[model samples]
Target: MKEKKRILLSLFRKKSNMFLLGILFFLLFFMLVSVSIYNTSRDTISAIERTYGTSFSIGLTPDKNDMNQWEDRAIEGMDSPVRTYIGPNVDEAMVRRITEEVEGITDYEAGSRADVMLYEYELVPGYHAWSYNYFTTHEHHLPYDPEETKNMMYITYTYHTRNSCHFDQFYNGAFRLTQGRHITPDDAFKCIISENFAKRNHLKLGDTLKIDLHSLNVRAKYPIESLGSVETEIVGFFELTYQQTVTQYTEEIDILENWVITDNEAGRALDEIIGRPYYLSASQFFVENPAELDEVMEQVRQLDWIDWKYYELVKDDGLYSQAVKPLRTLKIIMAVCLVVIVTSGVLLLMLVILHSMKRRKREAGILMSLGITGKEIRKQFLGEHLALGLTAFFFALIVSLAVTPGIGNQIYGAVNKGGEQKVYTEKEIEAAIARGENSKVAEMSRNQRTGVEPPKELTTRVEVKTALLVFAMMLLIVYYSVNEAIKKTLKLEPIRVLSMIE
Candidate 1:
């Protein structure tokens, strides 16, 4: 053991050998730290990608001739048709077909708003004046009498869907369930109301809430004479996370406070009673992988069953793209760096060991002449590298612990700065809109976002397991290089080795 220790110590005493081996050790240590940081950064980006998925909204395409005009439809019992400006809505069959047949589609939800009246409760006040004052104040000409439409804006409306879980509002943090559960496909005649709405109405879970569907008759806008009434049980209550500030033109019907959410069964039941067209106001479909969204959309567009003239698919990936663009770019950069560093590290270490071994031929011959076995000489070389490597690893670990976090945080900070760092509230959104930014951002703010914002900064720390992994990898490289180098030298006779010039 003492002799082995002496041989290992003597190996490092040679300045040439020590310098080369020291450089190799430090290089290997740096490679290890780089790999560790790459892994941590890659994981952080992957998590964000998973959180924000790519999706698209399907809606009706507008007609060219309908520019700046509201489409009017005739009521059953009116002298003239009321101006019921309805946008093109997605067909239920089309939504089902696209979601079922499309390979990349992971989830979908269909939403529609119904004009309805609560049996006993009035709406939470909106920005618009009372319906009576609204007509007198705005000078709005309509086929319907102002007296008959006086209570029209005071009734409750429903944001109805089959599965509330997949709705963008609920998927994002905009709407948070305060009590009870979200209405699922399995739920029947179940509904969710805003916490403020529930509190104001003194309603709770399991309470029966009756809503009367509005009549489209021009003279009977507030009565339930046409479509009839449907009873629903309160299943959930949600609280808005941010203040829903009303802009100057915000109307009574546009306010969220008076809106209720109902399940698909309730919607179907309303359909059976109202006998209205089966059209969805909006439909969103999420892709399983963001990278494949374009291919999936192409496949959807090629379907023969869909009529392209009336329907259009608009990509709704603003939030996902904004959040993931920087992360993905960083991920790709780290991956490329990891590959380059690890590949070069292996090659450089091997070349250094082989070159150093060429100089050790005379030393090996003399050691063999002194009765040192080839195996013993090999062990000495292995011991020397292992000692230097371990020492370098310890120093590298200390420096990496102090350095990697700053590097990681710098990368994350740059990414955060490039993307939407914070979710803008309605007030902030209004400010952004006033700045002549994309008006679409305001609509997006009211709808979609990830449940949690991407982390503000990334933190990387070298763990014990990561150190062990680096140690194991270094050990394997050292062992392989030393064994291969010694094997070549041991192939020759000791006299031949001793006679050869260094």
Candidate 2:
């Protein structure tokens, strides 16, 4: 036992061996720490992707130009995208049919959208009697020239009728009512108006307001002067709950800020006034398991009620895909790196252990001769390497504290396949700024972005848990490397080993 202790001390005292092993230990420790950081970051990012993108939606647009494609026969776009439409009142019935037949469809909703020129007199108790177009011209700032907006028969707000999910300002948590309640199907002729519109016109709940309603498509067929008026009762007034993405410099013109919501019955009532066409709204199919999206879409295309020639299915998961791209890419690279590091670590350290055993052959044989068993000899070597590994682990942790952030950035950029950085040309930005266009700036800048959302830089710390995990992993690797050396050492005869040393 005493000799074994002496042998262990002497092996460590050899400065050259300790120095080389220290470098190796440092590198091994760095690789372990980097692996931890990237793994944690990757897992965190993956969770976020799953949370936000769990529901994938399918949208079918209507193709009104082709009227003859509605037959039950093999639809032209069955294998491809076909524009589709719903019966005038079958929106809810169709939603029920899809949710029942599609095995993976978790939720279903339908919606109708139409821009209405809404003109109301005495909208507020005491306000100026100025023309309604003044607000559209000055405040609303419709993305149209004045002449195009001229002879418009109504004061406008985009009217919406939600069937299943209300992805509107209120339902999406963009706003909450300051007074009154959200309009529901049970309520007749009820509406929800934005706070900005309420403030601009000083309107309130339960106010019976009459608005001249006209559809642009209808106006093309009939004279604008012939548009009819519809009356509605406001049930709710909602205030902006949070700051929204600015699409234009004119804040007052934001659609959500001045939007209006009505139940389907009331909206449809307005649509049918004065021989207006009953608009066929689109349905959004939601699948809880996005992986089954393709299967669900196939089933939907096979439905007898749907006409494929006019209805094209669109995926609504692009945001999720883009958001998950960078992190997923990095995770794959990290996994590959982990494999290479571990395999190479095993090979490289095996070489080092083999060389170390050559120098200590005589000592190992002496210990075996002196009644120290082979297991004890192996244990002695393992103990020595373990101490070295622990020492190296601390040093690597200290160094990583200073360099991890910069290293993380490099790893992110590398795995991003040369697309890590957002590409925005100065000329384009300047042109957008000069054009006084907010939306154009986003459009121009997004021409090239890291196809995936660039992951936030990982912040690393030399915490106790991380230290313990890395230390344990290092010891495991060291034990594996030394196992080969032990086999070679135990096979050596004392006389032969001594002769070789001499």
- Looking at model 1, the pairs that clash are none
Show how many residue pairs clash in every candidate, following the order shown.
0, 8
Highest TM-score, which number?
2
Output candidate 1 Cα RMSD. 7.4
Model 2 earns a TM-score of: 0.68
Model 2 ranges with Cα > 4 A deviation: 3-8, 16-21, 58-67, 70-90, 100-106, 121-148, 151-190, 205-213, 219-226, 229-255, 274-282, 285-315, 336-347, 394-472, 500-502
RMSD (CA, Å), candidate 2 to true, equals 7.9
In the range 166-257, model 1's lDDT, one tens digit per residue, is: 66667666688889998876778889988888888888899988877766522443433434778999988988776665543344555676
Clashing pairs in 2: 82-310, 82-311, 82-312, 83-310, 83-311, 84-310, 84-311, 118-155
| Model 1 regions lying over 4 Å from their true place | 1-3, 15-34, 37-157, 172-174, 184-187, 200-231, 241-258, 269-274, 279-327, 347-361, 368-375, 394-410, 421-452, 455-465, 480-502
Model 1, CA-based lDDT: 0.71
